[model samples]
Target: MLKQNLQLKLSQKLSPQQIQLMKLIQLPTQAFEQRLKEEMVENPALEGGKEDEYEADEFSSDDYDEYDEYDNDRIEADDINIDEYLSDDEIPNYKLQANNYSDDDEDKTMPFAANVSFHQNLIEQLNTFILSENERDIAEFLVGSIDDMGYIRRSITDIVDDMAFTQGIYTDEKTVENILHVIHQLEPAGVGARNLQECLLLQLRHKTPTESVDLAIDILENQFDAFTKKHYDKLLQKYNISEDQLRNAIDQIEHLNPKPGGAYDNSNKAVEHVVPDFAIKIRDGELELTLNGRNAPELHVSKDYQEMLQSYKHSRDKSTAQKDAVQFIKQKLDSAKWFIDAIRQRQETLFVTMNAIMHYQKEYFLDGDEAKLKPMILKDIADLVGLDISTVSRVANSKYVDTPYGTKLIKEFFSEAMKNDQGEDVSTIEIKKILQTVINEEDKKKPFPDDKLAELLKNKGYPIARRTIAKYREQLDIPVARMRKKI
Candidate 1:
């Protein structure tokens, strides 16, 4: 048998304005400017510029008295007459006024890079060679198979299958290998090799053959594994060569370009430069902070929209069409006002949160010292600002601030705390810096392992475990002893 039961529950929901405010809080400076432009374009009631203080006096709530007439209608009517109100002839043009646009409309042009792709350049080189149509097809397929690293990752059998299925051209491994040889001889000198060893040897073959070149090729081709593992003793024993000879060979190998396709990176993506949201300057031993001017652009409700609303309100008679028009106008006006308010709120929130962080990490900012950064988290700032933790996180995650030292991400100052020898709390960032210094000063020929690193930290009063040392090393991007070893 099924029985009905009463249940109690609690829930939370975000209003539309609250949702929009959350999204606005997370946008960085450039993205926020773009969002403002979009809102202005979508709502003619919104305007952005340095307008005089007249906007405040014009849109005051007390100026709206047209809705007072409808306040007295309290009867529940069976049928409300539309024609009884006003005639169609009295209605004015209901089109949205776009007086926000300027009369001086000058066309602006944007700059863009004009360049060809890496593969296209390779195809152009292939055209110079005199080969049969099948050889050309196989060569083109191989060029397509080459990765951005300029290495051909496919096996000969896979290439054969690819050509058969896609290009509908049947070819054997021997023919594909011959065409690949031609590609390897291209201008880059390492564009068509299958592996790093082959790539290096191909580059060596292009160099003018000297004693060093010959020795480098021999070391790379034979004992490739031992050379990669930096087994200098084995190489010295096998070649019966002096240390200077091995060093010269290794120098030539290092000089050869490992990534032939790196030159074409500009063809795809240009480097992105950071635009900081806040700037700090140390004046007279005191710090001054200012938000980027772009973030504080002046915005207000459109004058034409305000005029339209006021005109619609003061008219004596109202009709169904006018009522609908009034509803639409009020909505756009409300949206424009809410958006401007939200922008102000976002700016205030950002300033408060960043100001708290700046004071918290004031020593680090003043000295450009990572060691001075205190242990902080999102909750600390949330508690200080009387906001939720998630709000603090949204501001901290995407925002960047400029300091007297340099531009830095706000998230960089936050770290977990640990107890030191004195039982005083210290930032883990300080521990990482100490670990980095230890690794950098270690003897390169015999780098210290994790256990030794842990012991050294303990001696310095950190008392960290070996596993934690490894974790911190990885965070700092320091390799293991074997990988960091040198001759």
Candidate 2:
């Protein structure tokens, strides 16, 4: 069935200027430094450091008309169009270059590239393989289908159908399977297989066989679910293998790469260093917060554009076209002024909110102790800063603060508090910390059950329910007592 409908909807949306301000307000210190540089490169009106000490009085907007006429003549001589220039637009030559690491720095150069771009590597290898042009094309296309984790998300049927429809090439399932087999034989060994079983088998085929290797393959091929779910008792009974033998076989299987694409990660190199946006230092028993100054470049209005506007205003003027030019110049200048003001506002707002957050979490920042972190939410910060909750959340989400303790995500400071048996409020993070400690010390042969954990917590004054304990355990990715059980 087909349906058509018309509805009128009214929505309040931020203008480009407002949206830019919102983004600016959320940037942390280091990011703000980069952001300022970007604005300096982009908007001529937003100067980075300071205005010139001595400039002709004619540089002001009041003389914009006179400058415009002079600029118009020069622009026409140069065959440059005025329409291409915007008051808020950045100059072309001042692009910010990414920081390059010096070779002398040991951490800067790694033994292997940080991330292995597997799919790209496979395609490169496929190019070296001896194949007919058509076979090469097909193999390349298949290689392209593999993802970073080294799995072909699409089915073979879907791929064949796509090729038939788009490329007009008839590729059978068997040919695709053969190409897949060859791909699996590549360095990573298990990349192109359709399922886990195939992925494991491809890796196993390369290894020298042992008695347990064959058994492990059988276990993987037949009872993969049981093996994965840690149903060791059932498997031991089924195979009549002792626990030590089973462990060895499991180790052998675990040694295989499930995704062949994983191997390529070391060979390819694209890595970025973590840049903390805010810096905090304690001096004279007070914490001082500063936005990183590196991100923003000093910007100023281009003298040429300023001169054009000045000249236009100076001319008592003549034609309708000249009047129109004057109006256009005024509009662009206004836009540029508005953008500069918004950026300034964003800077002030970011400082105000960040300062409040630092003060609120002063203990944690000073000590680098997670236990010292007070329970806080967006509303608490918004209240302190006299801003909206949403605004506070935005600031917290993207920003990072470098404390004496360590660089941490700003959001790590915020946590919901729960009331303990003593009626004292405690952060969920604190509870989680205690829970982790309890589990870490528990006997491996008989791990504490969730109910038992809850009872222990209650004895310690938390008074949480068994269900709450279970939920917290899951959040920590801790298995149930049975799953945690060990020989």
Candidate 3:
């Protein structure tokens, strides 16, 4: 049996131009510049930098007519007309120009320095030792196994098994252990240590022996658990030492590097540089916002391409080759126009969205006070700027704004709202800032716990719960009171 059914439904879809515009809006200043360079390279019809004065004056829409659609089979020469592309009015400046930057503006570029990696440095040091070929291979393999923190996280049995399977050099655990001991003797004192306790012990062993140093080693080897837990009274009883002697031992342990690999100059790692997309400055006690000039590049259609189209229009040839050439020219010109328009729209969208956010958090920007920030979310800014929440989110997620305080990620300004004792909406950022301040000012000898912190905040009109206080403390990377306790 055959049957036909009719079910009507509505749907929405984005055109190619709309998708391109959204992608452009999402890119920050640096990425946007890279995208611009890529476009110029791909599209010969597109040109960057200021247009020549003569070209600007002589430019006419009649020279570069846009066609609505193209046929796959062939585009007839008669279909192309110079008058069809010509407009009665002059071309808009945005369509032809994008030179927002001034000549005096400095062109800054990030500089990269070449250097060796941490593992390479360790491998080079192996040459100083008289090692056999087999020992050297094992040492190199172990060096490769060392993490950035300079610890060999794997076990001897595993390393031996891997060497047997991967490297085809079978060795016993005892031999690998001996080679590891040699690596531990390398500079940075703790480079080949297996764990934190071993790392601290290796460094202490390298120092000149003193009462405090020896006592520190004894504490680490025997009472490492008690030492780490800050069980000061128990240590004093176990060691039969006075407060001053215990303090000296504690001082030596604290001074030792827990992560020796971090001390090495690993300059080969790539550094991330943040180029702010917008800057907010206080001019005459008022916030003035400006998008980074780099975001607004001067782009225009190539004058030569336009002139070539004009020259072709006057030619008598209506051959297939000429029609194909004209069709190719139309596509590139259309792409160039769409790209320029998209860039213009991206600039406008960035400025308008950031402007709305600036006014929304004007109080905090005026003074570098975190407490002054009001409760805000993506929808709040989206509503203020009359844009979609996703659009606003894309802007906030990857963009940085240079403020008086410092360059900050835009998303840091947004936080969930919390009600105070007075029932006024406050930013969670404000509460966190105050919580950090209280912790900083507390007596380290007897640091305030979460319950006390919550009570103090309640007294100050915040009325936050103890569990919420704990959550906020963890978010701020503040340790618990037990961890914060001092000798």
Instruction: Kindly list the per-residue Cα lDDT of model 2 for residues 9-84, writing each as its tens digit.
Output: 9999666666777777776555666766675566554454434542212122342332332234433312322333
Model 2, stretches more than 4 Å misplaced?
1-19, 27-117, 127-138, 153-162, 262-269, 295-297, 479-487
Per-residue lDDT of model 3, residues 1-487, tens digit only:
9999999999997767788899998998888999999999999988877654423222234566444443355556567664443333334456444445675878876687777788898999999999999999999999999999999999999999999999999899999999999899988898999999999999999999999999999999999999999999999999999989999999999999998998885435668889999989999999988888888776766777767677787878667777787777767777877888787788888899999989999989998888899999999999988999989988887999999999999999999999999999999999999999999999988999999999999999999999999999999999999999887
Stretches off by above 4 angstroms in model 3 are 53-92, 95-100, 265-271
TM-score of each: 0.84, 0.76, 0.91
lDDT of 1: 0.78
- Scored by TM-score, the top model is 3
TM-score of candidate 2 versus the correct structure, residues matched by position: 0.76
153 Cα displacement, candidate 3 (Å): 1.7
Candidate 1 lands at a TM-score of 0.84
Q: Model 1, 149-236: lDDT tens per residue?
A: 8999889999999889988989899999999999998868899889889989999999999999999999998988988888888999
Candidate 1 segments exceeding 4 Å error: 1-6, 56-112, 266-268
Order of the predicted models by TM-score, top scorer first: 3, 1, 2
In what order do the candidates fall by lDDT, top score first? 3, 1, 2
Task: For model 1, state the Cα shift of residue 365 in Å.
Answer: 1.4
